[model samples]
Target: MKLYRHALSGHSHRAHLFLSLIGQPFELVDVDLAARAHKQPEFLKLNPFGQVPVLVDGDTVITDSNAILVYLSKKHGKTDWLPETPREAANVQRWLSVAAGDIAFGPAAARLVTVFAAPIDAEAAIARAHVVLKRMDDTLADSAWIAGSQPTIADVALYSYTARAPEGFVDLQDYAHVRAWLARIEALPGFVEFQRTPVGLTA
Candidate 1:
C-alpha cells in the first residue's frame, strides 16, 4: 500500500495512525503542498478533489480521511476497531460523523488558521471546539472509549485534531474526561501520534 499525504495534516495523520495500528505495511509518499503538487494533474488522478491522505491498496484507491479510516478498519483491522453488532457498528458510525462534522469544523479548522494561515474564523472554530469537547467529555464520563467499550476507528478518527486542539489556541484544559480519553488513546498498542506544529498557543 502507498499513502500520499502531508506531514502536518491532521487528516493525513489519522489515516497513518490507523494503518500503523492495524500493522499494515505501507509506503509513505509525501505530497509537496507548498509546490501545489496536490492540484497538479498527476496528483488529481488519485483524488479528484486534490486532497492529501489518499490511500492506494493494490487496485483499490480510497480518499477522504474518515473514509480511509473506515476502509482500513474493515479490511486490515481485526474485529476490535470496528464492531460487528448492529448497535455497536452504528454507535461507531455516529462518532465517525462527529469526526467528519464537528471535529473537522472545530479544532481542525481552528488549527488551519494558525498552522496553515488559512482564512477561517478562528474564534468561531474555537467556540465549536469547546462545545464538542464538552459533549465528548460528558460522553466519556462513564465510558473509556468514544463509541463504546473498546477503542474503534471512531477514536482514531477524532484523535489527531483533538490531541492538537491546543495548537489552534483552543485549550483542552477544562475538559478533563476528553483529556483522559486522549491519554487512553495514546497508550494503545502501535499508536502513532500527529506531529505537532508550533503555532497559536503552542507557539
Candidate 2:
C-alpha cells in the first residue's frame, strides 16, 4: 500500500497514526502541497479532489481521511477498530461524522487559515471552533475514547486536529476532560508525533 501525504496535514497524520497502531507496513510518498503537487495531472489521476492522504492499495484508491480510516480498519484490523455489532458501528460512525463535519470545518479549517494564511472569516471560524471543542469536552468528560470505551477509528479520525487545536489558538486548558482524552490517545503504543511545518515550509 502507498499513502500519499503531506507531513504537516492533520488529516494525513490521522492515517499515519492508524497505520502505526495497526502495525501495517506501507510506503509513504510525500505530497508537496505548497508546490501544488497534489494538483498535478499525475497525482490528480490518483485523487481527483487534489488532496493529500490518498491511500493506494494495489488498484484500489481511497480518498477522504475518514473513508481511508474505514478502509484501513476493515482491511487490516482484526479487533474492534471497525467493530462488528450494529450499535458499535453506529457509534463509530457518529464520531467519524463529528471529525469530518465539525472538527474539519472548525479547528482544522481555522488552523489552515491562520497557519497557511488562507482567507477565512476569523471571528466566525473561531466561534464555530469553540463550540465544537466544547462538545468534544462534554463527550469526553467521563469516557476515555470518542466512540465508546475503546479506541477505534473514530478516535484516530479526530485525534490529530483536536490534539493540535491550540496551534490554531483554540486553547485546551479550559477543557480538562479533553486534555485527559488527548493524553490517553498520546499514550497509545506505536504512537507517532504529528510534525509541524518547518520554518521554511510555513514561510
Candidate 3:
C-alpha cells in the first residue's frame, strides 16, 4: 500500500496513523502541496478531486480520509475498529459524521488558517471549535471513547484535529475529558504523533 499525502495535513495523518496502528507496512509518498503536485494530471488520475491521503492498495484506490479509514478497517477485517452489529456500527458512524462535519469546519478549518494561510474566518472557526469540543467533552464524560467503551474508527476520525485544536487557538484547557481521551490515544501501541506546527496558541 502507498499513501500519497502532505505532512502538514491532518487528513493525511489520519490515514497514516491508522495504517501504523494496524501494523500495516506501507510506503509514504509525500505529495508536494506547495508546488500543487496534487492538482497535476498524474495525481488527478489517482483522485480527480485532487486531495491528499489517497491510498493505493494493489489495484484498489481509496480517496477521502474517512473513506480510507472505512476501507482499511473493512479490508483488514478489523471489526473492533469498525463494529459489525447495527447499533454499534451506527454509533461509530455518528461520530464519524461529527468528524467530517463539525470537526472539519470547526477545529480543522481554524488550523488551516494558521498552518496553510487558508482564507477562512478564524474567529468563527474558533467559536465553532469550542461548540464541538464541548459536545465531545460532554459525551466523553460518560464513555471512555467517542463511540463507546472501546476505541473505534470514530476515535481515529476525531483524534487528529481535536488533539491539535490548541494550534488553532481553540484551547483544550476546559475540555478535561477530551484531554484525557487524547492521552489515552497517545498511549496506544503503534500510535504516531501528528506533525505539529508552532502556530496560533502554540507559537
Number of clashing pairs per prediction, in order = 0, 0, 0
Q: Which pairs, if any, clash in model 3? A: none
What's the candidate order when arranged by decreasing TM-score? 3, 1, 2
lDDT of each: 0.93, 0.85, 0.95
- Cα displacement (angstroms), candidate 1, residue 40, comes to 0.5
- Highest-lDDT candidate: 3
Over 1-203, each residue of candidate 2 has an lDDT whose tens digit, in order, gives 99999987999999999989889999999999889999999999999999989999999999988999899888875457888789999999998999988898887877777678778775576677889889888988868887888999988998998877766766677889888888898999989888864322133
Query: Model 3 over residues 1-203: C-alpha lDDT tens digits?
Result: 99999998989999999999999999999999999999999999999999998999999999999999999999999999999999999999999999999999999999999999999999999999999999999999998899988999999999999989888889999999999999999999999999999999999
Candidate 1, residues 155-188, lDDT tens digits: the string is 9999999999999999998999999999998998
Q: Model 1, stretches more than 4 Å misplaced?
A: none
For candidate 3, give the lDDT of residue 19: 95
Q: Where in model 2 is the C-alpha error above 4 Å?
A: 197-203
lDDT value, residue 89 of candidate 1 = 91
User: lDDT (0-100) at residue 3 of candidate 1?
Assistant: 97
Superpose all Cα atoms of candidate 2 onto the true structure and report the RMSD in Å to 1 decimal. 2.6
